[model samples]
Target: MLESYLQVAEVMFMQVRLKAFIIFCVYTCAKFLVKRKCEFKPFKMLCEFGWILTVLLILKITGITTGDFGTTSVFDGNVQISFNISIENFSIATLLNLILFIPFGFFSAGVLKKLRSKWIYGILIGLIFSLTVEFLQTFIGRFVELEDVLMNTMGAFIGYEIMVLVIKLKDRMKMGALKVE
Candidate 1:
């Protein structure tokens, strides 16, 4: 009981400090891939992030942060197996995991212009940023698996790439229609 409480406290500390940097790094990457000027709503990104974090916070407080929150894993000889999630849970939790990184990706691509296109740089920064968070979480009794870090980073990269593809396609279509006209 005492250990759990201590862990919670530590996780809370890491969450508060590391979340912002990770968002910033991801946003930088996202900008390179997304050129659509959301000039109309400058605060949209901030508001969106705020809402996500707030909702997640509520869920965390309510003890529903993640589907794999309370499961134990055992090493069976050469492999490790987890007993925390059901089939339904596996889907929801994995979906949640992917969704969790979307905002960070958006911020990196759409907001921070300095780190755009240079995906290697952006990903490295994000990875280091995430690693720090995971390290902090580890001491706090949170799941500090590298797989989560890899997934989050991959999600950010994929989201950024998708944005880039969208922008390029939009530009191409506009050009093609202009040529025909």
Candidate 2:
């Protein structure tokens, strides 16, 4: 079972990587063309691209792209919704769901300069994204679990906090270097 799970994960990872590569190529070409017409910071553009990739990866991982959505009715009997909050129910899937959204939060915090200081917005974004993904999963013949939503939100919050901490440390280091000079 573990081997099968790993195989599925590997396949999913490859699919997402291929899609990301294609997106990167197109984004690069677009950026090149747009750069000539407007002035935008490369860092901000990269951060925004990262967030887009993160969202695509999440969709792919959740079987949204690969599932039999065409045949599966949204109200099908197979569409399971679990509100299981028990820690004993934890599995590798739970961990992956949590890890998956970290990039979502990180890129969101990095790209939204005005919301950088507002940690609540990062959490809200995470929550909304997770909620949307779970809702869509019902149509894709995947289980929609409340636990997954909660874990994803927590992961986003953690990612946001890490980005904030990094910025603060960078500012302090710059200040210290200036003082030393």
TM-score of each: 0.46, 0.78
Tell me how far the alpha carbon of residue 23 in candidate 1 is from the true structure, in angstroms, after superposition.
Answer: 13
Clashing pairs in 1: 26-108, 27-107, 27-108, 27-109, 28-108, 29-108, 30-108, 30-109, 31-109, 31-110
| TM-score (C-alpha, index-matched) for candidate 1 | 0.46
lDDT value, candidate 1, whole model: 0.52
**Model 1 Cα lDDT, one tens digit per residue, 1-181:** 5467547745754664456446644764576459755344444466445434533442353234443432232222322323344444444445445555554565555545555667674576456645655544433345555565665666656655655565568679989999999
Model 1 regions lying over 4 Å from their true place: 1-95, 169-181
Q: Give the alpha carbon lDDT tens digit for every residue of 39-90 in model 2.
A: 5667667777787778777888787766666545564567788987989988
Q: Each candidate's lDDT (Cα)?
A: 0.52, 0.80
Which 10 consecutive residues of model 2 have the lowest summed lDDT?
68-77
Clashes of 2: 0
